[model samples]
Target: MTVAATEPRVVAARRRVPRGSARRHIIAAATELFARRGYEATSVQEIVAAAEVTKGALYHWFGSKSELLTSIYRELLAEQTARLRDIAEGPGPVQERLRAAALDVVAHTADHVDELTVWARSAHLLDDEQAEATRRERRAYHDLFRDLVREGQDAGVVRTDVSATVITHMFLSALGNTHTWFRPDGPLTFAEVGEQLVALFVGGLRP
Candidate 1:
């Protein structure tokens, strides 16, 4: 009789975890998995095992595997957007702010190299809706940086010969592809590399 009465409650209890340790563990595990194994190859079973959570926990928190992928990047993008927004609005000369802004982006990307590497490798595998959503988030970041460049131009510090749009793309392109060849033990320290990249950007902006 007791077993029969307990059966219903057991069935009712799903693996619903609140926004707590399990969710964070799953995200970190997934990020590492995707970075190391490639998103397409990583399986939900593997994620569950790595995260040490049940399948129900993953489903309870995230809608699907694609959502996990999007969340990883969206989380990073959100923090980056906040950083760029602060630097852009901070008190300073526009040219100095612009340089600082570009440096901030490169610095953050460098620090989260694995996440960036995951993004570079797995972005193409995302569906159209997922891809477009990520693009919009990225576009917002791009717009903020570009606006800073335009502000510099208006202030007569940045060059007028080149459009702000082109300058924005150029620096980002270099930074985005850094994962392809950059090495830690190379002759240039990462700091030196970042400084040189910023130099290339700021020098190009001179009127």
Candidate 2:
């Protein structure tokens, strides 16, 4: 029996999803599993099962467990980079812009705590190549915060004596680490916590 022309076209189209998309699906599945079960506990076989793909497919996309983790890390870093870029480019007073950016970070972390947990847990387990790649991506993200601090200083909106590096570290440490304590159903909204943090940094407790 001969197949219809449209049937052949549909079959061809089904076989032609972008290579990058397939890899992303694998990474996303692995990320969820790794978050629920730590790196030492999760197996590649289990990851493939959760992803609903063959072991061969997973292997074809990411050569090793470390590589898969690296891919997820890069994906997260890309997301943060894009968000920070938008906040940095937006018009507002420096203080307002910084507050908005901090709030957005907290909100994002709260929403994706699972992914962040996976990233934090597996970051140190990466191979040397993956480690270096993660470091570079992290630095790019960090630079955005650093620039915000510089802008605050230049505008005389924040303390000039405080190093931009220190400020940036403190800001991220507070925002990113919220995943450890934040509950989606908690009494305090992410925005409230973010505002408190911004206030602490911008206007210290001293009378």
Candidate 3:
């Protein structure tokens, strides 16, 4: 007896075939090479070889090396944006929510340090189009944090003297830089470090 192929089965198989996994694999390999060899020294051939994928596949997914780098950075930025949005929209007192938001930012950044490093190094090299896209994506996330801070200030939950933009920028810069000192096997967990950071910035632990 012959078996018939169904649409559902075909779709399921396609989904299970690791849709964007290959792209991520290439990005991971490229990130490692870039970190060790520097962006200019790392070649697409090396990246594909390291990822165990074909040059055609890499090209199909990301048109060029610069595009690949942009895609990877965008992926990391999107993850951060989602985390911040979730925390900002979570149900809690304004101050508590802001603290949670800050902690979430730190945790996500620490968790994806490799991607963060790639972003930090290569982001500035993106061409005008890529740079603009990244800036817009980043600004959307920043605006979310800014709105949250503004709400807190309006409700008298946050200090009224500081501008929301300033507060948001300060929190983002501090959390974004944590990758420099954060260690996966270190004494402090991301959560603990996040809390300490939030307390320092938000609560001002003066008492």
Pick the TM-score winner. 1
Candidate order by TM-score, decreasing, is 1, 3, 2
- Per-model C-alpha lDDT, please? 0.87, 0.77, 0.79
1-207, model 3: which lDDT tens digit per residue?
A: 999876653533322225557877888798888877878788999998888777888999989998988887788888888888888888887778877777777777666667777677777887999899989999999999899888888887778677888888887787777767778799988668777778788874111
Best by lDDT: 1
Q: Across residues 14-70, which tens digit of lDDT does each residue of candidate 2 receive?
A: 232355565666777787888777877899988876766777788897888888877
TM-score between model 3 and native: 0.81
Estimated TM-score for each candidate: 0.87, 0.79, 0.81
Model 3 misplaced regions, further than 4 Å:
1-20, 179-195, 204-207
Clashes of each: 0, 0, 0
Name the lDDT of candidate 2.
0.77
Predicted structure 3: clash tally: 0
- Candidate 1 lDDT over residue span 1-207, tens digit each: 456445343555545335578889898899899888889899999998888789888999898998988888889999999999999999989987898898898788877778878888788888999999999999999899999999989999999999988999999888888778888889986656877899999988999
Off by over 4 Å in 1: 1-19, 189-191
